[model samples]
Target: MKSIVAGLATEHAENGIGPVVLMLHGWGDSLHSFDALVQKLPGFRIVRLDMPGFGNTELPKDTWTVEQYAKFVAEFCKKTGVQPEYVIGHSFGGRVIIKAVSQRFLEPKKIVFIASAGVADRQNVHNMAFTAGAKIGKALLKPFPKSLYLRLRKELYRVTGGDYISAGALQETFLAVIKEDLSSDAAHIDRPALLVWGEDDIVTPVEEGKKIHRLIKGSELKVLSGAGHFVHQQKADEVAKLIQEFFI
Candidate 1:
């Protein structure tokens, strides 16, 4: 139940292995989200953490940017004496890791992003609509929550993944990630990277995975059939198998 105070992370770690593997959960998810993967990975020491305002972890007293969060994660790594040789991040956590890598934080020997979100390209008309909705959402909030906001996110949760996330945290994450354009920075990622996605992913989309593969030379992309936005959860064994294949 111990955690690093990034105002963003609460961690779970098991020591005694060759190197540490820090697992970062997505928004609305706790360290337990990575439970399946950790169980599959008996070869290395594993650490999973709850992100801010998502699970047991509290959001920072001050509103922090993704870059700041990246610094926090890096600082957390430094303090733990873990020296992770590999790192894994899911969804929103994917963005955070990229931000950290861009700033040259905890450079790992290998990195994996499951349904990542660094691509700036939009797929079609529907994506444009989502962008519009996000823009409108940022303008008003804090106390007066409209029905539209709740419905929109609940629908996204239902459609994208099965997790029922808090509207407030979802709104905050949406606002934080929408304006981000990681294309320029992604080109700089030189680590051995793996990008995986569910063919049915609605959140980050398979296109996002494709874009990551394209941007990061030599990176590999694997699209699992019949999987959706919460592919990591829905298809944990498959995802974990790939991670094992990549990490080993």
Candidate 2:
């Protein structure tokens, strides 16, 4: 289904016929990222959307922070009349959920975060260094041909594990989102929460999950073996089973 939320054209999907389970995908992913996981989750109303700047959803004209994304989710739910009983977020989507629920944007009975990002620790420091290096590299390459400069810049981002090259027009927004840590937000969560992490998740990593788990008192953390960043997709059955058990 398509709807206009926060003045942005949004693409979303609704399936099944039970309690609403809103699933938020990670950065660089669409609602389709949960295709396998959704299928495994039966007997629940599943809601997933192409968040602003991703999938078919129109990107915001101005750069947006995680708080803005949380507000957009609240507005989208209001516009769609969706009162999620259980909310699930993966990666970047998890960051939005944490900000939203902590701020009372959307109140779900229980929340689940899968390989969520938002904690700014040692990894963030490395990212800051990478950003600095990129800026210096850009200045040094200004005299080279535009094509060569662009190619080298892309390689630099790849080598440094930066997502800026893939952010496309939302590069500024990406910078804003990653720089803000959500540890305080997680600390404020009083609702029941479940965190799922991939044992081999180098993106957000297992340590980040452990940090969030500690922030949200009583929150349970489950680390799946042999899974990486896209644990929900890679281990759909295991993830779905965990969600089912947690929501129950």
Candidate 3:
């Protein structure tokens, strides 16, 4: 069910009972993405929420960066009266959790990252070349119908491996978030952390997980073979077991 937290309609599930473990999902994903893992984690209080814009929650009041997202989550927690004992995040959500913990917004004892995207992404020359090519194509096709222009733009993004979503405030927010580098923040997180990554993941890459492991003191890194970006979903049981052991 949806709960009104800090004036935003947040869809969440608070199941089981014990220590609180807040779950934050990745970009373009909702709280339901953690269902499989949550089912296996009945020993702890599972607090999973659909972050703003991705699920039933309303979009941010403005074009927000990673810090803004972390602040929103902090506000939500305060309004909901939750002080999490543990925190888990994936991809974009991981970025938020890192910012929150490093800035002392939330003091969870333990943390977990699944194919996280906190490290600033490396620049791709191929994408840059494609972007240049697309700009030229756009200039040439300026007189075309609006629908035709959009279709051509989508095709360009698909062919060039460019990350383009429909133009809006959320897309702008995504652009702002990706440009942020959280290496310094990772270095400041002194809590025990579990970094889990899919060896086959190309989105965040396993290398990023290694970087996070090296930055966070006493953090553990686990690579799951044959898993992709959604490692937690692909191997829900194993991921749950790992988290249970780590927190317990």
Candidate 4:
């Protein structure tokens, strides 16, 4: 375990492996989310980035979009010499990985998206309009505007479903990721892939996973029964097992 200005990172390595696996966490989550899986995978070196603004890394003033986050990961990989042979992205991280792969930032042997986003078919449960309302409500709450502020706050929650982004830094600290279709770019990757989905996933439903499987030619898809958006978290060992087999 070591510390960098960005955040704390822990590295684990297999006895003998030529490749590395880099883990990216879902939005509002930290690297520790995959701690158990990391310990279990002793055959391949694993590195998890505690993405800036979450986990050990302090939040930055520059609001991070998926592309910006991907670039950060790409640069981190370059500086660390940890050329990922495999990448496993959860939710928002999945979007970042797509950007990296599409832009040729990192050429991993295989990539995994665990209930990812960035696809048009994904039924976004989190309506982003609420995010803007929340910011507005918070900003308008200064001078005894209680009634108006409360009205806006309720409206925002009804839309975003909850406070995913705090109001303070506009597009600098936190911003909703613009939805971009990646079906074509993902198909072009041509790398081996594993798409794990939970049948009960509300965030990115199983249908989206199936569509992804179809788009990324020759990719494999696995659906877990009774699992939600966090399928890997619920069944970490099983997910790790599948990944281990694919990596080997």
Candidate 5:
């Protein structure tokens, strides 16, 4: 389904017929990324959307921070008349959930974070080093031809595993989003929370999940064996079962 929410054209999907469970996908991913997991979660009314700047949804005119994304989620729910009893977020989506719930944007009874990313302190150190290196490289190549300079900059980002190169138009927004550390926000979440992480996840890592688990009082953490990031997709059956059990 498509609707105008907060003045942006939004694309979303809804399936099943039970308690509403809104699923938020990660950066660089659309609502379709949750396809496999959604199929297995037949007991609940599953709603997933292509957030602003991703999938078929229209991107915001200005770069957005995580707070903007959280606000958008609240607007989306109001526009769609969806009152999610449970919310599930994967990766970057988890970051938004933390902010939204902490700020009372959406009062879901429970939350599920799957391999989420918001622990920016550890990630910031590496990002800072990369930023310094990029600045130096750009200065050294300043006198070079424009095309060559741009190509080299892209290469530098690729070599350093920077998501910025892949961000395309959302590059500024990506930078703004990652700089925020959500530990304080996570601490404010008083809702019952379930954190499911991939044992071998390197993107967000299990350690980040552990930190969030500690921050959110009464939250439970479950690490799946032989799974990496995207554990919900990689181990759909297992993840679906867990969600069903948790929501019971």
Candidate 6:
């Protein structure tokens, strides 16, 4: 464990030797998310950290945008005294990495995005209607008492029936991060990239990975059958092998 910032210590694991490899896990996940992959990558020095708000790391004092997370990652690299030769990020971690490379905080020779989540998917008809109705409901309830307004909001969530993340600060942070898409960053990244996605993933989806591949020059997309959002965890050995070959 090390203090990447004052009052915040990151829980991390470092092992092996050779070129430096930095691994960032998904939202609601921690450094241990890459345990199996870490064991398989014996030739490189692997550093996997529990990103802020997950695992042993403390949550951010307030909501943070993706760019803030990217800068925090840069600070982490500086504090650890290791510039990554290869960087691997899964889901929300991928958003941070995308921004990092685009902003030139830490230039890695290669990057691996596993079931990344940064693209803003097109809203389906149902979602579009739901959003419209929710807006109308909010305006209609403006004259109601505060308690009544809150009740109607909860009912609106029930009617919309979407899976919202955790409440309060974490949820607010999630909202802040997801609002920004990384298509521009993907287009700007000059480094070789490997995109791994689960064929069956609903969260982030295979389409999003394809979109990222299309934007990144010389990027390769590998779709694993029967895998989900946590594809790296589900197919750790295969993912690790791909990472090794991509870096080579």
lDDT of candidate 3 over 1-248, digit per residue (tens): 77787677888879999999999999888998898898898878888899988788888777888998898889888877899999999998999999999999989999999988877446334334555666687797788899998887677667754444543448667666766788899899999999999999998888889888989999999999989999999999889889888987
Off by over 4 Å in 6: 123-163
lDDT of 6 by residue, 117-169 (tens): 77645434444555566668779988989999888877876776344323334
**What stretches of model 5 exceed 4 Å from their correct place?**
135-140
Off by over 4 Å in 3: 120-145, 160-163, 166-169
Candidate 4 — worst ten consecutive residues by lDDT sum? 7-16
Every candidate's lDDT: 0.74, 0.92, 0.84, 0.72, 0.91, 0.83
* Per-residue lDDT value at 124 in model 1: 38
lDDT tens readout by residue for model 4, 133-169: 5567667664656787667656655456432434333
Find the 10 residues in a row with the least total lDDT in model 5: 126-135
Question: Candidate 4 clashing pairs?
Answer: 53-59, 62-172, 63-172, 63-173
Q: For candidate 2, write residues 1-248 as lDDT tens digits.
A: 79999889999999899999999999999999999999999999999999999999999989999999999999999999999999999999999999999999999999999999998486469767776777788798889899998888788788875578889999889878877889899999999999999999989889999999989999999999999999998999999999999998
The best candidate in terms of TM-score: 5
Best by lDDT: 2
TM-score per prediction, in order, is 0.80, 0.94, 0.89, 0.81, 0.95, 0.87
Better candidate by TM-score, 1 or 5? 5
- Model 1 accuracy (lDDT, Cα): 0.74
Q: Could you tell me how far off, in angstroms, the CA of residue 68 lies in candidate 4 after the best superposition? A: 0.9
Score candidate 3 by TM-score against the native.
0.89
Candidate 6 TM-score over all chains jointly:
0.87
